[model samples]
Target: MNAHEIVAAVSSRRASAVEIVRATLDRIAAAKALNAVVTVDSERSLSDAATIDRRLQLGESIPLAGVPVVIKDNIWVDGWRVTQGSRLFADFVAPCDAIAVERLKKAGAVVVGMGATSEFACKGVTTSLLFGSARHPLDPDLTPGGSSGGPATAVAADLVPLAIGTDAGGSSRRPPAHVGIVGFKPSYGAIPYGPGFAEPFFGISVIAPIARNVADAALAFEAMAGPDARDSDSALVESSDVDSSDLRVAFSPKLGLDTPVDPAISERLEVVVEHLAKTGLRSVRRDPVWPPGATEEALMPLQHGGLAELYGAAFQKDPEQFDPDVARQIERGLSLRGVDVIAALGASSAITTAFAEFFREFDLLLAPTVPCVAWPLAQLGPKVIGGKEVSPRVHAAFTPFVNHARLPAITIPCGCDGNGLPFGIQIIARRGRDRLLLRAATRIEDEIRALPH
Candidate 1:
């Protein structure tokens, strides 16, 4: 059952929370080959569900009553083992729940397990020395994409109806695109971030929601979003309804970066756009005028530097404990001059300003979530896209900027590639315009579903 149905069933006393959790745990146990989950505290999860049943008996209303949810390994859940997909901290346990997890528990969502993540969530694919790799449910030989791969897999595979992950550079969005589910990255401060692991993408990363559909993602987001004294970035903002007829939307296939998109993905996006237009949601071809040095390479020093600052000493003490890819990033970070980091921060500011200006003329921007379909497991990224050789970060081209600008963005399945693998169309809105974005996404999702496959 979906989260909404589970809530209704549990809240109405038609079903008990323990029953739902047991069924979910059985599903998780049967899907171990996916490697999507790193740990499951079955005993504790059942106890929590029993408590929720008790609460329902007392007539307390719960928004997510008895709904099982998976948390990305990087996010804390008090007493749960959270390795962040690294061997160095393989024995580590969260001392407390993250602010978002705390809120989820308060809403009566049961924590089923810790979903896997790349080491420090520093890589794009979700494999680690600690937890191996997570496979796409549709094709076990292919990856679901990562950093948030485990959470995306958990939801896509039906291990859980809702899951939470972090999106620093499309960790949440890209994975869901690969797995054919909904992933939402609200404006940076929409959900409180920490009391967890040190973030390599501080200020840019935001806690995100993953689910089978947009409404559930919105429900999870609403429950976790609000002001907190611990997270100064957190603030409550009211979302207003936007008139579909008056919405100014822009279609930027390349997101102004001239990034290469696979022909199959491009074709699917064009069809989806055509269908939406017939439904009265039309968009003009417009791309933001990005400032010089606004590429991902220019803004990467922050990630490298953040990693170095957080784990440089430990890395020096035991280099073999880290993923080789992550080790290289830390090494480069150690070599960076202070001026390089300042320049990267300046470029991020420029990118943010560019998007803000672009929004003055357009209320929404549409693009492909990723350039290609899911690729073979154990690789960093596709070596070539659209018949051209590309960098490993090429699959990431369309997404990281949304993080840099702290905008609200979502990815929903639009169509499938020739390989029968799924990809998503991304919808982005101005910073703090989450409700507007979700409303538009729901309409687009409905239109896409109505299209004849």
Candidate 2:
């Protein structure tokens, strides 16, 4: 069931919150082989659910009443181990709830467990030094995609209808694409990062929702979005009504670049694009390219730099304890000079301006969420896609730039590949146009249909 149904069911007393949570807990247990949930705080979660039942008995209003949610381990929840899937913090306990967790609690969502993530939520896949690889629910041998892989897999596998994850680059959106779910990264600062010990990736990482459907994502987004004094960047922009009929959408198969795209993915995306054109959109074929030398991989230094600043000493002293991939990134960050950092920032600014210019001609931008379907669990990404040797981060080409621009973006599963793996289609809108992106996604989802749960 989606969150709306859960709210209605619990609200109408058709099922108690405890009953719902118990069922969800059972589901999580049954799906334990997926290793999606690294920690299940059943005692606390049940207590919270029972409290909701009491509140419901009193006829109190709760918007997300009794909705079970899995929070990515990177997100703090008071008294829960808030490790970012790192060995250094494997036993660390959060002193207090991160603002996003507080908001979720206030909205009556029960967090049943902590989902696994890449070490420090840094990698694009879910294998971590602290917690081993999180398997895809559809295929245990394959990855769901990462940093947010645990949360995405939890939702995809029906362990929970909703989960909260973070997207530094494409962590939030990428996993959902591979797992056949909806991952939303609202405009940066739309969901405040507050009351947490540190801001990962220097605020490029935003706490976001991973849900089975768009409506649930929208509901969770609305519940958590808005102003919080703790985060000055957080705004109270009310969601505006958007009509898909009047919107201009640009659909690019490879974003106009000669980027490697698996033939199967291209074929599936074409069918979705055709369906989108019939949905009353003023659709055009246009590729929005980044300014020369601007690439999503450029954000790697920023990510590693932030990690190094926060955990550099630990990394240096205990390199063996860290995921080799994460350790390498931290070392790279430590090796960077102030000049290189400033140069990357300047390039990011230019990339943002280029996207702004592109958006002037289009209300919405569309592209494949990733170039290919989920690759093998043992590999980072496909070594070769569409006959081209690609970097490990090559699949991220379509995503991180949106984060660089602080724009709102969403990925909805469009279809599956011949091997039964899922692929997603991403939609991006101008900064602060999160609602418009959601509206457009809903219209497109209605036409193309989300992958079967």
For this target, which candidate reaches the highest lDDT against the unseen true structure? 1
Tens digits of lDDT, candidate 1, 1-453 = 999999999999899999999999999999999999889999999999999999998999999999999999999999988888999878898999999999999999999999989999999999988879999999999989988999999999999999999999999999999999999999988888899888878599999999999989988988999889999898765556545557999998888887788898898888988888887889999999999989999999999999999999999999999999999999999999999999999999999999999999999999989998888896899998999898888888989999999999999998887878999999999988898888899899999999876
Off by over 4 Å in 1: 240-245
- The C-alpha TM-scores of every prediction are 0.98, 0.97
Residue ranges of candidate 2 with Cα displaced over 4 Å:
242-244, 450-453
Score candidate 2 by TM-score against the native: 0.97
**Per-residue alpha-carbon lDDT of model 2 for 1-453, expressed as tens digits?**
888999999999998889999999999998888999999888999999999989988879999999999999988899998888877787899999888889889888999999999987888889986778999888898888888999999999988999999987889999999899999999988998857657547657788899999999999998899878988888755367655467878888887666889888888877777766665665788987677778665556777778789888987787898888888888988998888777788778887898899999998988989888787899987788887898888877778888888889999988887778888999999888899889888888887764332
Q: Cα lDDT of all candidates, in order?
A: 0.92, 0.86
TM-score of model 1 vs. true structure: 0.98
How far does residue 44 in candidate 1 sit from its true spot (Å)? 0.3
Quote the lDDT for 217 in model 2: 97
